[model samples]
Target: MSAEKITAEKRTEFGKGAARRIRREHKIPAVVYGHGAEPLHVILPGHATMMALKNHGYNALLELSLDGETHLALTKQVQIDPIKRVIEHVDFVAVVRGEKVTVEVPIIVVGEAKPGTLVVTEASSIQLEAEATHVPEQIEVSVEGAVAGTLITAADLPLPQDVSLLVDPATLIVNVTEQVSAAALEADLEQAEVEAGIEKDAPETEAAADSE
Candidate 1:
């Protein structure tokens, strides 16, 4: 992964007022912490940070230049304004080369399942251990021509030589289920109502008893 260079300045103030002032200046408040070191609070350019994040996501490698020193960090979290959608704060975690880290990678389903069958995904992301800089944003699984009852498990996924699955091998990720017809659905709903003691032709039992 290519490193994205972003200039940062140390933050001296704290609280909502300080944060608002920082945002007013078109800067984002961020904290860098990891590797069991003290957290460093800094300010980053809002627009550039946003753009870098859009392309690389949380795993984006940042070349943070602070106080004439550069550090390699990964974006951990970002808080954004609810209405404005502007970034409020960001969290960065420092990392070193060859360090193994756990991250959730998105799952991608490729191709269509068998014509009449529908594919249901039980897990949208998979957990894996990979190099901080080499963490994948997403993984693809091919379901081409997969028919009903076909289950894709974690063990079935193919990963890069450097990546390892952290989840259970028996965990089911995707399953192919047969689609039901409208008539079949209606019949099932009717049966469910019967089991629940409800019927369309039923009268008001309390009213009839009082009249009798």
Candidate 2:
């Protein structure tokens, strides 16, 4: 993963009002901290940061040019508005080359399960300890021709060179099960309704007969 060059300005202002003012100017307030160094509060170009993150994923490597010094950092977290989905604040962790960092990589399932079998994913992402500069964007799991009763666990996942799993080897990742038939699905729905004390409406003729 190549680092993106982004320029940042040191920010002395604090509080919500200051943050809102920064956002209004198309900049994002961010803090960089790690390696026993004091947290550096700064402002980053909003558009450039968004574009870099979109191209590089959440664990993006950034070359932050602050003042006259350059700092290597990794994106640790981002706060976004739930309604607008726009980034509000960012947390950056300074890192050095050749260091290992723990991160969660997304799990992607590829191909299809065996006919009449359904593939259910139990884990959406896996925890890994990988080189900070070489963290994988995602991991792929192939389920092609997997039959019912097949189980793929964390230990079974393939890892990139130098990457190690941080999760338990016995943790379940994917499970293959027999697909439920339409009749079976309907029966299950009916059973759930009965358990909930919901009664099916009678036909008009049956209601009239009962009235009589």
Candidate 3:
């Protein structure tokens, strides 16, 4: 999980107008704060930042070149326009090499379960601790040939080196259950209609009942 190199600029202006100006220039206004240091207001290249986050997800690690020096940071938060769908602002946490950071990585279920068994992922993401530079992009769990009644927990996830699980091992991640057939579903629906005293309307003879 090497950091993506991005060139950033120092931001001297403030306020909504200033932010709009930055966005108009195709850049995003961001702040870097962490490690007991004052927050540094900066501007990041919009396209590069967006692509990096898109490719690596929210836990993307970045190496920012600012003012002839380099700073290592992890993306903490992002704000996007609701209508325009463009990034408005970003917040970064300054980090150092070998420092362990807690992050949530999405669980990717690959392969297929046994036929007639539906695989359901109970947890979409898992919380873990990893080094700043070696954080995993996503955790992959293979469900190939899994039969019904198969349940995978957080402890079953295979982690990479230097990574540790921060979540409880008993946390459910995937559940494989028997799938109901369409015929069975239709029969259940008919039974429910009979139980509720509701009948299908008849052609030309149907009338409003129970009220009218």
Candidate 4:
């Protein structure tokens, strides 16, 4: 994916109050660090930054402009408001072209499994080592016509020629299991209620016993 170029303003103030003041001006605070250089604190445009990350997906690379200099940074972390869903803070790491970087790419499942089987995903993402510029947007796993008892592991994932998996090969990723029918679910629920001493129509049964 391509990097989104954003103009960044150097931030001189810190703390919660300063951050609030920055957000009041339609900007958000961010930090760029890594490669042994000092951390650079800056303020970024709120709408632009959010849109860039949203359109480019997670682990997006950014080309930043600060003063008269231009630098490349990769997204490391993002903090967002729980209720408002606005970005609060972002962290980035400086990187150069051709550098092998480790990043977590989201796993996307393609195609439908065989009928009567349900596809269950155990992990949502997988780690990979690849060039900073060519970091994949996502990893795809296919379950087309896969039958029950089918299991897909990390090693079974397909990757670009230059990319490599960083996690354990045997890590479970996705599996195809038999789908539980409605009747089965109702039966299990009834059994659970009985075990918990919650019998159905208990009041009616008590009234009938009293009459007898």
Tens digit of lDDT per residue, candidate 2, span 95-176? 9999999888889999999899999999999999999889988889999999999999999998999999998999999999
Rank order (by TM-score, best first): 2, 1, 4, 3
Question: What lDDT would each prediction earn against the true structure?
Answer: 0.89, 0.93, 0.93, 0.93
Whichever of 1 and 4 has more TM-score, that candidate is 1
Off by over 4 Å in 4: 186-203
lDDT, model 4: 0.93
Clash pairs, candidate 3, are none
Question: Residue 154 CA error for candidate 1 (Å)?
Answer: 1.0
Q: After superposing candidate 1 on the true structure, give the runs of residues whose Cα lies further than 4 Å from its correct spot.
A: 201-212
| lDDT tens digits by residue: candidate 4, 1-212 | 78899999999999999999998888989999988999999999999999999987789899999998988999999999999889999999999998999999999999999999999999999999989888888899999999999999999999988999999999999999999999999999999998999967659878899889
Q: List TM-scores for all candidates, in order.
A: 0.90, 0.90, 0.89, 0.89
Which model is ahead, 1 or 3, in terms of lDDT?
3
| RMSD of each candidate relative to the true structure | 3.4, 2.0, 3.2, 2.4
Tally clashes: model 2. Answer: 0
For candidate 2, the 10 contiguous residues with the lowest summed lDDT are 51-60
